[model samples]
Target: MGRTRTFDVNEALEAALGVFWRKGYEGASYADLVVATGVERPALYSAFGNKETLFLRALERYASNYANYVPAAIERSTARDVAEGVLFGAVELSTRFSDRTGCLGVNGALAGSDEAEQARAALIAWRADGEAALRRRFERARSEGDLPANSDCATLAAYVLAVAHGIAVQAKAGFAVDTLMAVARQALEGWPRSGNTLVAEQRL
Candidate 1:
């Protein structure tokens, strides 16, 4: 039988993910991955196929690991609460891993070249999935009478999604968590209410 692999694959992948998260797809070179993962070029290729494949894995890992707050927020709260939680959660996530800095999905790549196009598409799709989830949650809220009967669930979802992405952008730009949270609160101030305003009574 072939010799058993010595390195921990999950650990190596996490390290490789860090490199990709810090540097976008085009910027993260093979040499960079090697240094980050502590696995040589041959092993990296054998384990993960190629750079694009590795980046795609890293992107997926980032989504499952760090980008899960949107759904969690939607599940545990009111429609207004969902927006508040997502915006604040974005700030918390983007700033938590100081070295990584910004969200992997939102800041994973600059404008894509032909080679980086697939990676860019993967990130966009991940973001889009979150938006879709929020939309569904808002639609449910509207159906259940948590929101106004005439509330545009699609527009509200898009609005919250935009605010979350904006939080990521600001966090990547070095905005403080307090500053970002303040921004989140301000966004809630304009959140469309049912018969009465929820923003006035809510602490968020």
Candidate 2:
């Protein structure tokens, strides 16, 4: 085998992820990553390539490590449960870490500079994938009679994600878990069910 790698790559990546979570893509400097990872820029570069590549790797790690809620929410038997699962999960996640208050997906690139458009696009696509997953789940829910036949699954998905993203923003701004849970509940108030509203919309 080649010479043994000295630093723990997992720990380095985890540290880099924490820096990205707290500071964001454009906001996080090499110095921040260096301090966070306890690895010099040269070693970091040799291990992970450029900053963007490191951030992308961190994104993959975040998805694998933290975004388990997406699938858990999707697997719920009812559409309402799916929405509630994600919304409440977002609330929990956004407030779980005191140091890194919000979501990586929301915080990592939402505040990027114009020069960081590639990173911004990556986060945009990240959220879009979530919306697509929710939309597919909602379509299944509609077929299973958990949602109105005329319910706009795409809109529902977008609405839920919008609220979830909003929760992240608010959490970063120091909102409490109870406050975010209230927001989640308020969002669920508009969840479309399979009967009267459907008939009313049909009649309209």
Candidate 3:
């Protein structure tokens, strides 16, 4: 058998998570991982396989610790509350920390090398899952009369997530919480209501 490990695995992973969160998958280097985790490359490899694997692990950690608010937001009673909850939760999380200002899922792999395609695809799927969750909730709301039957729940879900992602990008670009909140409000005002508003919008 091999020798026992000296470092805290979870601690190292959290540190690596921070590196990946702040820098992104293609941007984060092995040197960054080593410096952040205080672990040598060999040890890191032993613990988490390779950089891609480590990034995937960090994504899991990010979802559990940080992105958990997405589900909570979906639990709101009203469709407007759910949309607002998601946007509010997104901005709060994106700007909560001074050091890491963007979401790990969004920042992890927006666009990168062909070498990291798997990691990039993972991020896409992760984001798609979130959008799918929102779509389902919105569809239920439509069925319950919270939304107009022709509201195009999937489009509504996509719009909410698009705004959420835009705010995250703005947060990374140094936008303030109040500013993003204003943006969220502006987005909400455009939400579908009665009298043939966005109610007329539908899918192809």
Candidate 4:
């Protein structure tokens, strides 16, 4: 009879996700994954094929878990609430992680090379799709009388997404959570009010 394998695939993948999340694709070595996942090199090669394959899988897992949090927040709240939640949550997420790794997709885009260009493109596309989705939600909110007709859904969506990316970069640059939060609040408060007014509101 063949001997039973002791390691769990899902658990191993989760561990690998952490290493990749912290060090990124190009930065994470095979030894790093081996150490993080507690799996033998042969087992990793057999299970995940190669380092690129394993990193892609880890990216998928990271996107599946963390990327969805923003959309989920959108689904659970009003348009304004969605915007605020996503921005604030992103800031919190960047800082809350023990390793303080920045956004996985952002890091992937920065570190991935031509060999992994497709993966980087996919991450960029995903972020764009997220912004578009937010624009649609904002449009719906406008139609539902939740926002003023003059509200520019596309621009607001872009602004919010830009804020998110800025937060991610700042987090990666070692900015404190409080600083990011302050930036988020400032962005939120600066959002154009109804009737095309450009004046900023008082802090919430």
The lDDT of each candidate is 0.83, 0.90, 0.90, 0.80
Candidates sorted on TM-score, descending: 3, 2, 1, 4
lDDT of 1 by residue, 1-204 (tens): 876677888898899888887887888899999999999898888889899999998877777787788777988657888888888888899899888877778777758789888998888888778888888998887887678889988888888878878888888888988998898899998777765435435644
> Relative to the unseen true structure, what is the C-alpha lDDT of residue 107 in candidate 4, on a scale of 0 to 100?
74
TM-score of each: 0.92, 0.92, 0.93, 0.85
In candidate 4, how many Å is residue 186 off? Answer: 0.2
Record all residue pairs in model 3 with backbone atoms less than 3 Å apart, i.e. clashing: none
- What's the TM for model 3? 0.93
lDDT of 2 at 152: 93
* Prediction 3 global C-alpha lDDT: 0.90
Flag regions of model 4 displaced more than 4 Å: 1-3, 195-204
What TM-score would you give candidate 4 relative to the actual structure? 0.85
**Model 2 RMSD in angstroms:** 4.2
lDDT of 2 by residue, 1-204 (tens): 765678999999999999999999988999999999999888999999999999999999989899889888899867888999999999988998999999999998766578788888998898899999999999988887778888899999999999999999999999988899999999999788887436646887
lDDT of 3 by residue, 1-204 (tens): 997999999999999999998999999999999999999999999999999999999999899898999899899877888999989989999999899997888888889889989999999999999999999998988887778788898899999999999999999999989999999999999776643324534421
Lowest lDDT 10-mer window, candidate 3?
A: 195-204
Error of 4 at 73 (Å): 1.8
Ten contiguous residues minimizing lDDT sum, candidate 2? 195-204
List all candidate RMSDs to the true structure: 2.5, 4.2, 4.9, 3.7
